[model samples]
Every structure is written in C-alpha cells, then in structure tokens.
Target: MATGKTDLGNAFEDFKLGQRLAHATPRTVTAGDVALYNALYGPRFSLFSSDEFARGCGLETAPVDPLIAFHLVFGKTVPDISLNAVANLGYAEGRFLAPLHPGDTLSAASEVIGLKENSNGRTGVVYVRTTGVNQRGVAVLSYVRWVMVRKRDPAAAVGEQSVPTLAPAVPAADLAPPPGLDFRKYDFALAGAPHAYEDYAVGEKIDHVDGMVVEEAEAQMATRLWQNTAKVHFNQFERAQDPSGRRLVYGGVVISTAKALSFNGLQNAGLVLAINGGRHVSPYFAGGTVFAWSQVLDKAELGGPGGAIGALRLRLVATVDRPCADFPDKDEAGAYAPGVILDLDYWAAVPKRG
Candidate 1:
C-alpha cells in the first residue's frame, strides 16, 4: 500500500546494511518533563530528586534521571526505525556519557549494522546502533538495539545476513560517572539509605518489596511524554487483529517502574552508568501490578581505595502480579517464571562510605 504523502514508515525490505538514519525531533529537557517522570515512576534517587543533594555531590543541580534521557532518545528512533516493527527484541552495550540538565536538547541518529530475514519469511530482524547527542553534538547516550520488523512483502528477497557480535557486558573500567562527581561529603542521612557501597556484596539478592500497578492512562501518558509513536502502544484498531485486542504497554515503562521500585533496598545505587543488556521477557499490559527484585552480580571501585564512588553490576527483574519475596527467576533450564516480564542487567554508580 502506498502511503503517498502521509509517510507510513520503512518496512524490513526497505532497510539496507550501512544505512544511516538521522531521526527527526530535537526535544529540550524541562522541569515539567522531570516532574511528570517522577510522578509516573516515583523514583526517589536523591541525586535526581534534589538539587541541593546533587550540588552537595558536586553537580550544578539535580539532573534528569538517566532513564528519562534514554527514553527520550529511544523514542526519537521509533518513527524511522520501528514504526512497522513487530517488537523490540533487546538492548546491549548502552552507556550514559553525560548528565542531561533541564535545558539540554536531545536528538538521535542510527546506523544499520546488521540484518537477517527470519526462516518463516513474514518478518526479519534489524540491528542498529543509535547515538543520542546533546545540542553541542556531543554524544550523551549510545546503545545497540535489535527489533523484529514486518516485511512489506513476504516474497521479497533479503540480500545478506549480518549479525553484530555484542559484548556480554560493558567492562567496568569503561564506565563513566559525571565529571566533578564526588561523594566524599555525601549525606547518607538525607539520601534515605544508610547502606553505602561497602554494605553490598556480590551475589547478594535484595527484594525491592514494593509493587506498582500499571494504569492505562499513565502508561500511555509516559509513552507520549517521550514522544514515542509506536502504533502497538496506541493504535487499538491496528492491534485489534492480535489475540489480546489491546494496546501493549511500552517496555521502557516497565524498566522505569522496576528501577523506581528498587530504591527501597538499593537506594544508594541510583546513578546508572551503563546498561550491559536487557530483555522484555514477556509482554506487559495495563492493569497488571509490577513487582521487582535485584541481585548484585559484580562490583567495582571507581576512583581508587579512597575513591568517592563505586559501581555495582546488578540484575534487576520485574514480574507482573507477583511479589519478589521469593525472588522469582529463571530455573536451571533458563525458563522464567510465569509472571516475569523484564530482566535487566546494568552497572550503577553508588557512593562509597566517606
């Protein structure tokens, strides 16, 4: 079908290896965006929640949560990259390079690094590495994501199969915290967590012990806040053909909600340095309650023995309608529990005891 003037977006067959797409829309971060994000996710990370606390730790003011920046940047790619996508498969090698203040403007661009048609021939996978840059053209965030996209014509022949080899996790040495960041004088009393970097041990599990119900209004509002235009998230008529006959909740919503819920136990580990990898284990819909748990996979000291900051490699899992007291997870064969919806691996900056 010809879209003519209306721009229906690119199909799998329309993409070619090495294609570069400079996505449209540059959005300036704002106080309203920050407030709305906080309202939606209820994140209580002191660094992002209080300007005074941020200044005490050496920032000019509290910065927007890194995930907000991630969502904004990721949302910009949807029109050109995944408007016709069946689903976003996974994310890898994501790094947050800079803090985004309220006034900073963000834009994105992506390079098609790989492509392969599915054996079934109805759809294919597309790999792209996207870079989000601020107004000065400095890259603020970078990540690689693959999506399953529908083909315009099932009979169309795909030229070649190229899959990029991704590192299992970002090396700890490569993680970057903001410049001038010093937790030496960090106020643990005001931060709401007595436990610092020294208190957590590798292999320890922390049940966030909280759950938040996903409401239809808030989920759609969050997707719109990031300017995400994915049809599956909003077009009921388009989704009517599917068995569920409902709009799908955006995966980013689950990530943010689960991260917010983690604050109860991992309050000190607020600043995310890098997302090693993540997967939407299953589809989530509105009206389901989300619960989460975290396990410390690894840890690193950033500056030295006397360094003010450290990093924790964490596995954060979110499950629908299931409390995490039992730590619901994959079995020996790696099958997730029936309620599991998200599994995320990432490195976070935590303040060391000063």
Candidate 2:
C-alpha cells in the first residue's frame, strides 16, 4: 500500500527573497461548474447562471464568477508562499483585467516583491504579486499580498530591507466593479438582498454564522474550476504517495465559503472595498466541517447620486477541526491557535436607511 505525505511539511524553507512560484496544472471552466457554485452560494445573476441572460448582456454564454479568479491565483501559491505563514497582512491593487468564460483554462504564478525583518527577529514579512492567466497567456486577475513568516532559525542573519508602507484601508471609490456591468437592470431577488446604497453603519461588526462540511468531490471540483492545477489539491491517486493519503481542499474555498456566510449579516453591503487582511492558519481537507464567524470593525458614509451609502469594515474567521463556539478570542500573544482555518479583514458597501 502506498502512503500519503503532507506537501507543506517542509516547503516553507525553500522560498527565497526574489523567487517566483509558478503552478503547474490548469482547470477548465465549464457550464456545470458555474451552475454548481451558484446553486450552493445562491448568487443568481443571469450573466453567471443563465446562458439566455448572458446573451442579453452581449455575451455569447455564461461567464465564470469573478471571485473564482482570486481562488485560482491564490491557490497556486499556497505551497511556496503561505504554507508556513504566521499571518496575512493585507491585499492591495487588486484588479480583474478580463472576464473568464466557460471552456477556458487558467494557470497562475507569483513574483516576490518585498521582504522585511520583524523587530522580534523570529519572523519576517514577504510580499508577492500573484497573477492568473488563461490558456492563451492573457492576464485575468492580479493582486498583492503580504504575509508574516517565521524564520527557520530565530538567530538567522537578517537581510537589509526597508519595510513597505501599506494603506490603512482601501477607500470605497477605489473599488473596481466588473466591466460592462449595469446595476440598473440588476435582479434584486436573484441578488439575494433588498437593501442597497444606504443601510449600514461604520464600526459595526457582524458575526456571519454558518457551517459546512467540505466533500472530496466538491473540493476537487472547486480547485479544478479555478484552474489552480495544484497536485496537492487534486490527484488522489498521487496523494496516496504522501503520508496523509488524502488531497487537501484549496484554502480559497474556505475563504469564499466564509465570505458567503457573511452575507446573512452583511447582506446590504456590496462591492468588496478592500481585502484588509486574511490568514489560513490551518490545513483543511475532505470531510472537515468548516464554520464561520465575523465582526464589524469600522463604518463610513459615502456620497452618491442614488442616496447616502454606508461601508463596513469587517473581520471574518473560518474554523476547521472544530466549530467556533466563542468569537474573537485570542491568547496573550495575540495569535490564532489551531482549529482556525482563516482570519480575514475586509470592507463592504451598504445602502443607508433613509
């Protein structure tokens, strides 16, 4: 009998300051794939869920969800970028350059852009620009992420590098909506929200409470849909070559699942303002039950012709190996312990109640 091994066990030490990690494997987008995601998440926009609806918008067929691009690109870097990360600081300059359509395949790569030593000397920070491309080598999605990584040795000689100045928060006006999107014809019932542009407050934290068990089929389907092409995420036959004897669920699934759960409490909020931060603290695999919790961090009012709109900064967390019984718990050292799969900070826009 063959054994399964964890690919991430010793992968962190291999990352260098200026190295680029390119993932091998690509996922083909399909109509069924789009249907499954919409059915599970309840995002009923016609462009993504209906071929007829897409034609009305001047597209030949339904397109993949925009967020799926993030999954494809981010999943590719897990082995080399975040396998041993302590925390994710934030995301900046995220842009969706092109729409992904069914039948297209996608691949991803990342380039390290910055590195810094922590004052504690036991860890350092690494920043990278992750990009996703289609089979024809057309860029689809791109973003910047920074992570806190532990040093292999606490006393390792530090590199002389200057820390980069990160934004305190991404402003609401800076959010990039999908190209050719017209909210005037948006289906409110299908969109799953009745409120718009005026019903939120700043500094309010909402706990999005829901739980789901990731199935093997679902995990493999999602990983493939993003065109992540990571061996650890697929190839159950190959996975048996490792010690665990199982394939791991892509971490981006957990992040997206948690974001979906947040909709119950933050439903009015639209357009992700910024990814203030995120962390995948633990590994998740098939049969693992994932639960989510969220808190409101800050709120802001924006001026627009439709009316006054509100934006809420939020912290969303996902847990595996166990459910979240209490929210926002931290030890003396202020680190998330095991059972926590994700800790994310973001901003969203909501309609005000006039």
* Predicted structure 1, TM vs. truth: 0.97
For all the candidates, what are their Cα RMSDs to the real structure?
1.6, 6.3
Candidate 2, 1-354: lDDT as tens digits:
444764532223344566787865676767776667765455433345666655544456656767666766676666667655654555666656677887888788887777877788777788888888998999887778886776777766755464556566566566543454333443445546675544444444455566777777887877666555545566556332236676766667787777666666655453454576666666677777777777777766653433344566777788775666565446779987677777777766554553
- What TM-score goes with each of the models? 0.97, 0.66
Cα lDDT tens digits for candidate 1, 151-193? 9899988876799999999999999898889889889989897
Q: For model 2, what is the alpha-carbon lDDT of residue 135? A: 85
lDDT (C-alpha, whole model) for all candidates: 0.91, 0.64
- Once model 1 is optimally superposed onto the true structure by TM-score, how far is the C-alpha of residue 102 displaced, in angstroms? 0.5
Off by over 4 Å in 1: 240-244, 304-306
Q: Name the regions of candidate 2 deviating beyond 4 angstroms.
A: 1-29, 36-63, 75-109, 115-126, 133-140, 146-165, 184-187, 224-248, 267-273, 299-312, 321-326, 331-333, 349-354
